[model samples]
Target: MRSVWPLVLPVCSALLSANLSAQPTETTPATSAPEMPTEAMNSCLQASIPSAAATMTVAELRQGCQLLYEQQLQSAGESELQEQQVSSEDSTGDKGERLLKRRMTLEALNRANRFMLTPHKINYFFPASYTRTPNESPYRDNDNESLSDLSKAEADFQLSIKILLREDIFGDNGHLYLGYTNHSLWQLYSDADSAPFRETNHQPELILSFTNDWEFLGFRNVLNDVILNHQSNGQGGLLSRSWNRVMLNSVFERGNFAFALNPWYRLPESAQEYPGDPDGDDNPDITDYMGKFEFNAAYQRKDDIYSVMLRNALDGDNRGALELGWSFPISSNLRGQLKYFKGYGHSLIDYNVDLEVFALGIVFTDLF
Candidate 1:
């Protein structure tokens, strides 16, 4: 592997650029060239053709791969000219429909910069959130304020968005963006507390996504992301919880079904000098419960979407989380949502605590 990258980097560069639109070339008469063959090798050669690299040098693979990419590009463009088709994933059918819409159509090839802010994740709000167990350990720890009375029902919401910063920074495909997401839990029913915010987690991230149209088993793997993420619940001493991660995400879709793989390596933090110390890791064992990998899947039927998400630490303790959800159309942009969660990682403050929650809410959008 060490020797492989250097040897294939130049060849791979030529395949999609495989960042991977082909370089522009002069067109000749149809008789001038023999069309190169690409037998539905859907993605760029770099990702799907490592085995082939063993036998060829960059010079040998460049010409053939580029020609195949060109043909695929030509055919895809032609297909788009036929009767327009709509994707179930973009149920709202709004303009600038992103991610999935981009995946299901050739519009993704139009990588020209029409920079705009877009939703990063599913934005949702739950008005009747009921949790059986409220982790009060953090509030009881030294240096933290005490909270004697708590409510079993409250409100929860999350807002997430991203903006394109640049396109094709490296080659023809890498698009960069800045993103932020905030999740808040409110004691809406606690009149004595004046509807205080019980917990709030803020996430700010830098994202680099490599766009592609790779196909396998009727699924198109459309998005690849490399992210630098920082998440924290702003607080002092024992209530403080924060961590950083380098995460990789790969997203795939086929018809109304979509799936994603999310995995991350937590950046190391210094050990706290003492409990409640502010200048060190707020939650060093975060990975044990939040897990290093997560799998998410969703399927849509008409106006309804069924989804499930799983996270696992893959260690002896078997810590992590599971969530199941159903979202149905309530309006053009708003959808009714019902969700249940068990285990950990519901929020930064609850990352180590096991709890069960059932919530009814409205989501601004669906995951697909």
Candidate 2:
């Protein structure tokens, strides 16, 4: 049995070797690797693309990846800078709003003490007045030649202006101001001699004002001002008129109505060297008719304004003056005015002279 087994194994091995030798011998090339998962493929690309030189150079892939990353970083930086600029502009707008609020509050509290020369009263121009008095004309009357034949116009006109100097002086409740005002009577309609200025009165004043917050007798005190005032007509010979005074003014308000009381004491001036001279007190008895105190009252109803001024000696001598005025808006900053002045002292030249004047004009400013 052992001899038969060895002979059979030898025969099997010989047969297997003969069969393998009889078969053809050929080579088969390798195929590509199988696809990986999506995420794994991306990571593999990142890791292997830089080193896979047959597909692309590792250095070129690295440079492209760096450029892409740099572009992304630059876009992010620009977005961040734009956001910061918007934030800065918002901060500036907030600051401006706060500043505006503060300024508005200040104005509400102290409107009168604001700096700059704002107008205090109506400044206007008149084309004419009815009555014309040339009693104390600057032109002289001589025996040889009477100047009464001088060419004079019956119609007259006037102009006035006021300016301020200081505010909030000494304290927050006080103000100091200087003002110059002029009134001119022009004979515009008189064709003879081409019409000239018949009279021009110059008035200048210094005033110290204080806020008064007193309420009594149904009247609330609004302002109190002390004034050093001078008025003159710069004329020679018979037409000169001038005066100086220290005056006190008290203003009160109630609802839409306001009132002012002003009392003045005339300062003594040297008598003229000669009679009817230009440089001295032209009218010594001027106060007898002009009075010691004046009263002014004003009322406002919607867009309409009315005012009245009165002056009297209280002596029953039937002396003093009265003026009534009404104003209504004609435009945004302009108003049409109707004024009636029947009194003495309409001008320094007319201080001792009585006249009735009615005028229509535009008002650039208002008292209230």
lDDT of 1 by residue, 307-340 (tens): 8889999999999999999877664346788999
Could you estimate the TM-score for every candidate? Answer: 0.71, 0.63
Q: What is the lDDT of every predicted structure here?
A: 0.63, 0.52
lDDT of 2 at 362: 67
lDDT of 1: 0.63
Clashes of 1: 4
Worst lDDT run of 10 residues, candidate 1, spans 1-10
Query: For candidate 2, lDDT tens digit of each residue in 1-368?
Result: 00000000000000100000000112322122222345654564475442332323444444333323333433444211110112333322222222222222222222333242434334666554555554444344322123333333344333332333455566555556565566777657655445666668766677676656678897667567787777777765556677777888777666556677788887876677787765566778778888878888766554566888898766767678999988776654456778888888877766766778787776665543
Best by lDDT: 1
